[model samples]
Target: MAAAVAPTDQGPLAGLRIVESTAFIAAPLATMSLAALGAEVIRLDPSEGGLDHQRWPLSQEGASLYWTMLNRGKKSVTLDLRTEEGREAAARLVCEGDGIFVTNLPARGALAPEALLDRRQDVIVVTLDGSPDGATAIDYTVHAACGAAQMAGPAGLDSPVNNAVPFWDVIAGRTLAMGLLAAELERRRTGRGQHVALSLSDIAMETMANVGILPEAELSGEARPRQENWVYGSFGRDFETRCGRRFMLATVTGKQWRALLSATGLGTAMDRIGEAFGAPLDDDAERFRARHAIAALVQDWAGARDLTQIADAFAGTSVCWSPYRDAAQLLAEDARASPRNPMFARQAHPGVPPVLTPRTPLRLSAHPRLAAARAPDLGADTASVLGPLDTAGKEADP
Candidate 1:
């Protein structure tokens, strides 16, 4: 909006424009993802900021790192939607922008999908709600309701263990982006636009169904017991090295299972245990059934060696394993998390110090990936985006 700066890297989504009224995770993430792919995303907020403006994981200067990261590569505009003038201005912007509108906020009155579509018949409106019934819910609530939380913790634990990450919200964000693209494609083909609606709870439930959780629960009339760190239907779990560093090892394929045995020098021991149990350890089901015995031997082998020795042994092998590390350790040790990875770059945002920011993870063979950009200051693009609105909320003549 600020004079339309020339793009250095035009991604596959170049020229696609999106106007968003959103907050928190899913909607913001969806727009940000589109922005990374070269869409011009104009994000609308209240004058003070939206609900997530002050959300946690703040920088030392009290800037919301979460908000900053999610809204990167987007133009920020502020409007007081509670007023009739503000609502009219917002509706005008949505109708004028490449006919695409996205929001997780309530779409009603002037900004409703019906109203926007009436203004421009080809408008593609994407809306995400907590549930189909319009009940309030977030990632944590959806995860808990979908029975995932109950199956997440230690095997013997009495209570449900909630994951720290908001996986459902993340999934919903990507899903919304996909839906928007699909709608856009349809609009292009038929010259008609439609509304794309999604619910966070539906995303969680459908994912559970897709992963066989719902059917298993229905057929067995029971919930899956907590599995701790073990990979389901395979040989995998955590083990501690001699230096007390922990690593997860998983053998999902026969090659990986054989490699695990070979690397740990436990082939004979595993064979003996299989013979005692009257099952071959090579079979996936058998491996899962005899996981305790297999894990014990692997743990003992790992406990006798340091992490470096374990890494050396597994290097260039089919043994799938990784050393556990915290966030600080990931930044310090892992090359993938650093700027060495093509997906990441050190960039400065408005109020925070320069930090590692990421462009879209998706790689397109046809187009170059756009570089990540910092989020704009609140209302930074309001004048350029909306021009000078009159007292009646109409765009004034230039």
Candidate 2:
């Protein structure tokens, strides 16, 4: 209630303010990014708290690191929007706020219209929905039904496997931030407010646009099975090297393939190794792996090795050596130069950096991208938020 800290140092969207009426990932993240960019973001949550207040993947003492991570430096207001009093309080706040984000979707019989749009004419209203248009599904359900989980990998002996990570969250977070920023940018230009809506399903589909629509693009609905770590026409697949030191996983391109051959002690002339590893069949996966097997033989292939080493080794290489990193590992560095997160820091652990997912990848130089207030703590500033309501409350208390 005293001094509200701006989330980041970016000045792309300076002087912008947003109100969050979201429950979980998508909506909150959208607003969080806005706050990170120096926008005054006030999150409206339920007084009772949501599922995230005490969910899984906890710390040793059962602390919801999940909640802490997502809501690191955000202010929260626990007003009951379902009640008339609560609605009025929120309406008043939204009417005055520059931006408002909600988890409610838009469509046939969906949005509450005037109820949530208290400031329809004054502020930016961003919504996060559950599904795309007429359909709906949760994160896991969507991932399972959509073919992402199916194509994750081949079974050792039985059924297929699913990716362990919550890939949809990452994708949806990205989509939500992008949508919110887009809306904010437009508002800045027009000097008029607008509503921006997005759904987890929509975000998920967009994230998998290349693969989800691959079947449709090819004129066939028969989707491709899990390729695991292999892509078509790409030889020299990821394999374990000898000495069990680290894994050599990368997206080998044509030029990179030549380098790999030389790096692994193979000769410059391709014809020389044809008899031993077979001829390079252009983009043949089998031939590439065969030729690349020599390097794999010495590379520590299991996932046990630190993924960082793999990424570090390919820092400036032509090889699209895209190694898979866990959510925690990626945010290890401070704000990066390419659309970085200067606001993200270890507010909880001091010097220990908190784990971050990823930024929206959208950049704005002139506009303050981050530098806003943290999410509130269950209407902690209710008196300040709804001062008129407080006056009314005092008058009605007999």
Candidate 3:
């Protein structure tokens, strides 16, 4: 390839380089973030591509949309690390440039910290694992272990309900990105590399800690109760509109509650319902305890009007509400057209239609705009990458 185009202004991570040897979401997403911020990210996959290359939700041509979305704007090199030559090439790739390697692969045997550090002492090695002790796990298993599945469904359901979103994987990916950036900054200051390790379980625990869920349960000896379609500890729920559209509404503050009542024209009805319970619906706790009564009034009002009518009513109010939309609806309205979407870049692949992908959410005035490029096909850059590595190895030979 001709010299990579040099942008007039590079992003905040302009001088950084990250070598990624991981499949799936967490590790790939972490490096992708760095790549978006202008880091040179070179990803390594097995000779036939990693498991993620075959992930479902593919295009008509059987290309992995999941893999393409996660690995966007990164160079891809495929190698069979089981071979001695492949191992040498992998080591050379790790030791090249800024010498930062991120992977979720096994911590022992091949491609471990010891092996990479042996190749380059100043190499920054970051590994994300299922547990701190190197146990293997994926998002679903980690999410299940974190207690989220148990509290997911409606009240009175005995079975666990797994969420559609891979919550732990998303969090762990961001966590890994945070660690990589921090290590980069420290490496710049100290001129020394470090090994950053993160576990999916640990990330889940941190998330619980941040939300105060574990502490609340420990102190009160009360497990979180399922409140399907309702905001936990609050008076919010999903109601069907006259047009058969489901909408979620929440009011966290007194002002919001008053506005919601006004928006629905239900203040008087709420007052009457509150009187039936001999309780004033003036606080969150009261409304929460009497949520059934409150929801009845809301349902009656909301059910009598179409989504458009309800949306018009909410336009000038402080009521927090949105109509439930499926994937197609969201893609048509929010993802494709909404100004709120930060990842709005459109990239065209050779045989594929243009795709709209979200970029890193960080918005920095000093940083240059991120590059918009499609994910490379398997081993697309292998010759360009390995040719130079081979030349360097021969030149350094005695």
Judged by lDDT, which candidate is best? 1
- What's the lDDT of the predicted structure labeled candidate 2? 0.54
Better of 2 and 3 by TM-score: 3
Query: Which candidate, 1 or 2, has the higher lDDT?
Result: 1
Angstrom error of the Cα, residue 98, model 2: value is 1.4
Candidate 2: tens digits of C-alpha lDDT, residues 1-398: 54444455544555666666665565566556655555666666667766576566576655565565566445666777666666666665666455454555331211244444443654656666677565666677667666566666653424545556667766776677777677667777887666676667766666567654554545775766545555544553455423233333443455775555444433444444455566653445645455455333424233333555544445566645544335454444423422255533323321223443333244454443433233334557665766765676688897
**What pairs collide in candidate 3?**
343-358, 343-359
lDDT score, candidate 1 = 0.89
Q: Residues 101-186, candidate 3, lDDT per residue (tens digit)? A: 89887544446788877777788899988887767788888778777788877788998987687778888898898998888788
Model 1, runs deviating above 4 Å = 1-8, 388-398
What RMSD, rounded to one decimal, does every model reach? Answer: 4.0, 6.8, 4.2
For model 2, the superposed segments whose C-alpha errors exceed 4 Å read 1-10, 60-62, 105-111, 114-119, 133-136, 155-160, 189-192, 211-213, 216-221, 268-345, 349-378, 388-398
Q: lDDT ranking from best to worst?
A: 1, 3, 2
Candidate 1 Cα deviation (angstroms), residue 96: 1.8
lDDT of residue 208 for candidate 2:
67
Best by TM-score: 1
Q: List TM-score per model, in order.
A: 0.94, 0.71, 0.91
**Roughly what TM-score does model 2 have, to 2 decimal places?**
0.71
